[model samples]
Target: MSEILRLDAVSRHFSGLKALSGVTLRIDKGEVLGLIGPNGAGKTTLVNAVSGVTPASSGKITFMGRDITGIKTYQAARLGLARTFQIVQPFAEFTALDNVAAAALFSQPGESLKSAREEARAHLAFVGLEAQAGQSAATLTLAMRKRLELAKALAMKPKLLFLDEVNAGLNSAEVERATQLIHQLAASGITIVMIEHLMKVVLNVCTRIAVLHNGVLIADGPPREIIKNPAVVDAYLGHQYAQRNAAHG
Candidate 1:
């Protein structure tokens, strides 16, 4: 597959702290790459920088071969880059369908409201939220809201999607459902950068895993290889699993 996104020594700083430091990586076309790290590992910062939610302090970001390092969120969305937040924030007063339709109409060129709503319903169905389409966003449960977020992002028809903690507060069943949707999207040829704390979800859905700690990328490899790496376990997965593995050996 062709390369779709590249972060060359990207860094983001606030005051004296570096949220992301020289994190270099690339996403090939049609791969689901999971970003795993501790709570403050700069995972979100890295995604923010890449998706134009926040500008990088240093380095280059090339998306589809265009330098888009510090482009604003709206500009990036127009370029087919979209992301879901850790908090699923929809337009509370709008119906779920309208929320998604607004996204489709806003980012996609020449999509009329009527057409957008039709497209929105399809995306909502894809995420298993079609039945709740007419409900107000605030009326939806956490799981439904999360699905709505995914639907809204899909409405944008993004080429590269950043899913930031999509399974944050989900039950096992909801996570499984989210995993399935992620797999479907990946299989459908979307490049995804997923930041997740749920290892089960990551292991199940990611093609490869990237690790970050203290604003630095410590490792990048296939999930199996990543799980076995002592450094990765130490920094993120903890030494308990490693100790058990060693004891068994």
Candidate 2:
């Protein structure tokens, strides 16, 4: 598989506090890479920089062999990179189809509204929102809203998709559905880089897992090894078990 995206020595600072430190990673064609970390680990920041939601302090970002550093978000979208926000932001007043249509409009190549809406309907169905297409986005349940967000991102027809904390607020069943959809997307040839808090979701869908702690990458390996990393256990899982273990000890 070819390299679809590369982040070289990526670093970001806010008021002298480092949010991401020399984070270098690559997304290869047809791979699902998981970004896992405790809160404040800079997982979202890394995604933001790649998606051009924020300018990186120092880094080189390349997409499909083209330098895309500091490019506008929409331009990045046009370049076959799409992303979903941690917080699902839909056009509340619009129908599910309309919300997707808005995304399609932004992704439209030749500036035709008709063609965009036509494409949007297909994406909504792809995310399993076809039955709710005519309902207002505001009226949808949380799970449905999440699916709509996925549909909106998919409407961009991305070669590489960045999902940030997509499973954060979902129940087990919803997360399972989301995971299956992600698998489907991967099967259809979309390389995915997902930042998720739900360990199960990451382990189930990702081929490789990348762990971050205090804005630094500490582990990059398969799920089995990653979950066993002493560093990862120290950073996130220690507190939950240390007290209990001490009580028993």
Candidate 3:
């Protein structure tokens, strides 16, 4: 697979406090890479830097061989990058269908409104929100809102998708369904980079895992190998038993 996204020694600082420190990673087309870390690990900051939600302090970001560092957020979207916020933000006044339609309007490449809405409808159905399409966004439950968010992002037809803590507030069953939805997205050949706190969701949805601690990437590898890294375990993998054993040994 070709390299779709590259963050070369990327760093972000907020008023002298480092949020991401020399984070370098590459994502290939059609790969699902999990960003796993404890709270305050700068996982979301990394995503923001890549998506142009915030500019990086240093280093470089390239998407599809083009320099995209410090570009505007909408530019990132237009460059085939899309993201879902940790907090669901739908247009309260619009119906769920219109929320997705708005995204289509933004993504429309000189397409008509009728065409955009048609695509939006398909995306909503893909995310299993076809029934609630006409319902107002403010009236949907958390799970429905999440699905609508996915539909909106998908409507933009992004080559690379960033999901920020998407499973943070979901129940077990909802998480499972979300995992299935992610799998379907992956199966359709979209590359994904997600900041996920739920280990189950991370392990199940990602073929590779990247672990961050204190705004630094400490480990990047397959799930099995990442789970065994002493640093990763100590930081976020819940391996206290192993750490205690090693201490005794």
Best by lDDT: 1
RMSD of each: 1.5, 3.2, 2.8
- What's the TM-score of each model vs. the native? 0.96, 0.93, 0.95
Query: How do the residues 139-218 of candidate 2 rate in per-residue lDDT, one tens digit apiece?
Result: 99988999999999998889999998888788889888899999999999999999887766787899998888877888
Residues 1-249 of candidate 3 have per-residue lDDT tens digits of 899999999999999899999999989999999998889999889989988889999999999999999999888888889999999989998999889988877866676878888888899899889998899999999988999999999988899999887777889999988899999999999999988877667878899999889889899999878877889878876777456645765
Our tally of clashes for model 1 stands at: 0
Estimate, for each residue in 1-249, the C-alpha lDDT of model 1 and write its tens digit: 899999999999999999999999988999999999899999999989988788999999999999998899888888999999998889999999999999997787687889999999999889988799899999999999999999999999899999999998989899889999999999899999999988778888999999999999999999989988988998989888777656866
User: Looking at candidate 1, what is the lDDT of residue 98?
Assistant: 100
| Alpha-carbon lDDT, every model | 0.91, 0.86, 0.89
How many clashes (backbone N, Cα, C below 3 Å) per candidate? 0, 0, 0
Compute the lDDT for candidate 2: 0.86
- Of candidate 2, the 10-residue stretch with the lowest lDDT total is 240-249
Clashing pairs in 1: none
TM-score of 3: 0.95
In model 2, which runs have C-alpha deviations exceeding 4 angstroms?
109-111, 239-249
- Score residue 216 of candidate 2 by CA lDDT: 87
